[model samples]
Target: MSGRSAAARVDEADYIVVGAGSAGAALAARLTEDPDVTVLLLEAGAPDTALELHVPAAFSKLFRGPFDWNYDTVPQPALEDRTVYWPRGKTLGGSSSLNAMMWVRGFAADYDEWADAAGPAWSWEALVPYFRRVERTEDPADPTQGAAGAQPIEHQRDPRPQTAAFLDAAREAGHRVTAANLPAGQGFSRTMVSQHRGSRSSTADAYLRPANGRPNLRVVTGALVRRVTFEAGPDDPAVPRATGVYLEIDGITRHARARREVILCGGAVNTPQLLLLSGIGPAEHLGERGIRIVAHSPEVGEGLRDHLVAGLAPAARGGTLYAAEKPAELANYLLRRRGMLTSNVAEAYGFVRTAVADRIGMAADLPDIEIIFASAPYVGEGLVPLPAEGLTVGAILLRPRSRGTIRLASTDPRDKPLIDPGYLSDADGIDAETLRAGLAACEELIDTDAMRTVTTGGWIQPAGGEHMTPVERAELAMRRYSHTLYHPVGTARMGTDSSSVVDPALRVRGVSGLRVADASVMPNLIRGHTNAPAIVIGEVAADLLRGRSSSR
Candidate 1:
């Protein structure tokens, strides 16, 4: 059976924003604020009306469900040919609706690096305002943190005792407890999430929902954009102008014309996929797929980067989040909006520079690894259900040296892209060695008396890791158990260099009336989760649209 309906009539709008996701939702809302601009936002998934979408703890349940794109990468050689499952939200808020709800702003130095790759306007100082504009944080350590922005960021309302123990263990292990959002932020802290009270505050909830009533704004769900429709420029026949998008809505093929611009916020994966499908990627690749070349951009799906984590689970003494699966916990969530259901799984996070990174002369401003503490055992890279009552402490590589690619599987838009996240493929093996150090830190943290008190039984993941040297165990575990943290970026990286798919202004090279404002345009992966930065990118796009000279 066909996934879409029969062809429908053409639609027209002043502007068309593809993918009502983390960036699209915000950008569409911001653009429509002008009232003069009639904006149409298209989403491939259904609306975010499900109760589970708002419940923090239920995020994992949405995976492989109707709301997820449910993408799986090609077999990774470094991870023993494991084809990692990559879950991206197919709903209005994109992955923001399905993410762990972390609101990390990323390290300042990471943005500085972006500035180097793109332009000075992308520096930390220039982007901070956009960060503040997108967030409404509560009780942030820095006064500069957003206090009254569209998205609500709240401290964890109900942190697990196991997580508290993990923090103490981190401190005992000589790790400082610092804020993850500040320039000098580092250390262990309860995670701050994009939530309102206890409910998940997705971009849909924060930006799109509020602008839902606008007459100038129109949101259509279940609209699959196949390709960007282009026309030859008036004077320059060689240059193409994106007039609109060719999409399938209600199984009906239709054209949604954009009078002004067609902005793509389809995230790191889909944005590049759409570009490639529209024949905007590598000439040879598109030719092989029988796709007519509209624009030949060789770097479209290159430079893919993602975070990988080694699971470090230990059996817990008593209290774990498993009890939340019961009826009583659901009742607690219904009545008081508190309990395990309010948890965002990975409830605590920290950034650290391991001895390996420091000794290797890596950038001191960037963290080599990030420690994530989950109240419950998250096995099988969170694809597997909780096996038992336990605590999970993951050692995540922050800045992996390896790069990957997203390529066309076929000319058909329905076909999934070929994802090759060349993880741990660095020539120097630095990515693997850095992860080893992080896993060692995880071992050090868990071995502390503070963590040991909460941990009762033996290690759940990499059972009996203590037998071998910590580095050896980490290497084994990394090869055996390392999986994506679900933060992928840089596929359609923005820069001034010839290899860049998009310029610093986010305009696709050799194309007009088209722009990309999403994680895909990030020149470098931030030293944090991609959610906050993605939203900030939307804010920056809005500012640019409003005729701002630069982000600063």
Candidate 2:
């Protein structure tokens, strides 16, 4: 990937992918594998050259920093009217560069619902090949695991003793020990991270950077895509098609045309925001903002779903990952990329069905909540600094019932969009009740003999909830301490329904030569982390585009 001078410009390419993120990087690299297809990859942020980006334990340091798109949501009603902060990666690897790097595939039923919404092509069985195609696991002989793939995913090499205790506590609390990526298992396992030899394996490192030198691929950094440009031929005035992007490069506005298609890989938030900015969203919302609407698609920024977690942190008897912040650990990381520096913070996790699931009429087969056990206090959604040596047990609602919206604060491309996650605002109050149950479950796990062996103090954040009832304590803790798990999806959902922004093939419904290939197209929230599945989405999108391009 030769660096281009600020004055350099590419007038056109066979394909243009906006956002050189987890999905975009993979898509661009895969498309360029066909030497005939010239691809232009545009990234808003500068190159990811910082040392901390590759270090696993340093992920939280990037939050709200220069590399983060540091967005905040509208005040939520259920959580004491608190505004939540969201950290999205702005660099070449996107959020993959900034995220905890946990590799989770979600449940099989999650894709079954996707297939039901889209087609059989998105079924769990159908997506296995793409999953395998995107991941390189440690076990080559294992049929379920990938042997040789672009992304490196490995089991936690050296889990902290506290992590093992959490797993033991989970077992004592009635959950089973499960495989790393089992779709049906409602139990605990050490986290599988997107890393190789202990360092982060962001899509930039796994796919884009390795493939950047290819003659067919041109990567442009610090290019902020303002809007997608659509044009019509003189012969077909009514049928306007996506032509390229209007981008800002080093303070200069430039246009880059696409000969084939313009793909949006800007994830759930930015993709919808860009679509609205490009005049392709609901008519009334666009009109209200005094912006012209090219496509009156009502579902452009609707159906926003995300996972919200309430942290239950107990002071630990043993030392926490906070010790890794010292200079000696830095030396260890620099020398061998091992030790506490390799920790993803969220060291172990489990899926569990709480009693509230039956009350809320949730599916029995689907887990209602996820417990991510961090070796340190991951408070304030990893935004707040750790106060002391503690173990954090995060109770995450797997599938929220409430829906939210992403709206335009204004037409300005530089302005951040209005993000309203509508967290715990389900009319039926199911979301809140389910989360309350999850909190109770977390308390149960913490109170177990296994956890008691490692923990030192009582509830850290709730302050005085020790004497309160489990339900009351859960309610208090949830109301005062809940935050996003950073897994927002479904802003521009893909479905067969007319309300969907994209079709089953991921093409924008009202626009030709344009498609969304990221979390924004998810019809529903999945049951696990989004990183690995997002890479798979890119692989599937590349195949979909290639199939159509080949036919033509």
Candidate 3:
């Protein structure tokens, strides 16, 4: 093992990207295309070339293990005083490798809303080309869709029998099912996952690994960035420019200089926390904490948001749905990369608009809730102890009405930050209502001729002949099973306003030679999973840094 001291290598690079996760990998790969530019990517986690990472069925195993930065949230009020566990990947690919691999390009209007809130360049019309550039959609040249890029997007192979039955039930419930990514009408549809053949196509696999061999790119693992080092000129007291970063490795601290820019790709929580730790947040807050205030930006850690979902455990007709049951299926996966192991568990999905979207005149494209039909329920707590049998249908509220924040529990980077995602905090919060709609939709499936053959009974919480009304069931569901969609964003929002941390160009407010190119820059949460959009942000930011004029 070659352990180089950070102090010995205080060399400068054209760019220093913190957090070698999804956005960081893409940004590093794109920027290093120019052979003259030297790029250094620092990650707190190890690399992701393990065979376990390649096996699609082993995703859950990666959670809370060495690869994951397992952080627990404060007890959520809406979740019956339950502290939700957040498993973010701390490896080379970050959450992209550990995630369920659901490839969701958020609603078209979600980007349009960005444009409406921030600037014209962020609109769907502006960002679609970039989305297309980063992804190789499975169904290319379908007019409404196409795939011609690095990331491979495809439909699940050998979906479970229960998946097909669930779709049939959704159809019988009077919802429309379609093959499109952002399908029309309300109902269930198959999920389009981020997989090529059978392996997960993470940004690390698609972008970083290929670029790793380049001489100009240097990747340092297990390097935890502590704070941004600043230089204060005698004349300028308010604007202290960031020249480098203070990073810790194996209990030793060192500084790495950035000649051009220091990009923060540390996701929502860590990004804002980093800024605050570096004295770049609200003046009063930092001053009260006995820290010098460099930039008094109030929005550094405000406007935090995330997607919330309620999991519904349905009764299975027979034994468990573990992929290990089918030996031949496993053999096919190990041999030719084709089998049940290749399937992303949330095989079928549907997007529907609740009453809230109706009031807003949201189009069919703007789906608020995404219902995932899985072959089996992901039972057991904290990523361990698999259940012997059962099925799970997850109802995710894409456009959450509630907001939360991420603050420093202390200045120590080792200590987990305070994450408070105020789920179901809306009077018009669509979580409860949307979940009821999902339950109704699921019941519709149970009643269908196809599902009747498999489903033996109902397992709605507070079970049995109890006089619990639908409203009561919905509320109970919200309390019992509402977990994170793992899509946390908007803590360090980008806009042209004073409250914004970064501007439209992703330049951090009141700072030079620094930018943020990650999900944290989102002004609001996109109406779907965030991996695709985070990649798009990196792609677009690369173009901007390369001096390319905006086509939008």
User: How many residue pairs clash in each candidate at the backbone level?
Assistant: 4, 0, 5
Task: Please give, for residues 1-552, the per-residue lDDT of candidate 2 as tens digits.
Answer: 333435556679999999988899999999999999999888888788899999999999999998998999999888899999999999989999999989878888999999999888888888877877888987542365676789999877667899989989988988888778875654688888999999998999999878877889888888889999988734566656899999998889889999999999999999999999998998999999887777789989999999999887788885789798888888888998888999998999988888788776777778989988899987766777788788888789998989999999988888999999999888888888888888888888989999988987566656555666777778866887888888999999999888789998899987788999999998888999988878888988999988832112
lDDT of 1 by residue, 402-432 (tens): 9999998887778889999999999999998
Candidate 3 lDDT by residue in tens digits, 1-552? 111234335467989898877888898998999999998888888778687787777787787788888988899887888888888888887788888888777667788889977799998888877877787887653443546777888878767788877787777777787764552233456788888888988888888877867878888888889998888633576567788899988788888998888999999888888888888888877776676777888888878788777666656776335644388877888899986778777788777666666765666556677777777666443265445445666667776777888877887888888888887777775655666675655445555787766766666333541355555655666687667878999999998787789999999988777899999999988767899889889888888899874342
Q: lDDT for model 2, on a 0 to 1 scale? A: 0.86
Candidate 1 ranges beyond 4 A from true positions:
1-10, 464-469, 549-552
Predict model 3's lDDT versus the native.
Answer: 0.77
Colliding pairs, model 1: 4-251, 5-251, 6-252, 7-253
- Checking candidate 3 for backbone clashes, the offending pairs are 137-147, 169-445, 189-349, 377-391, 377-392
Which 10 consecutive positions of candidate 3 have the poorest summed lDDT? 1-10
Relative to the unseen true structure, what is the C-alpha lDDT of residue 11 in candidate 2, on a scale of 0 to 100? 78
lDDT of candidate 2 at residue 156, scale 0 to 100: 70
lDDT score of residue 137 within candidate 2? 85
TM-score versus the correct structure, for each prediction: 0.96, 0.96, 0.92
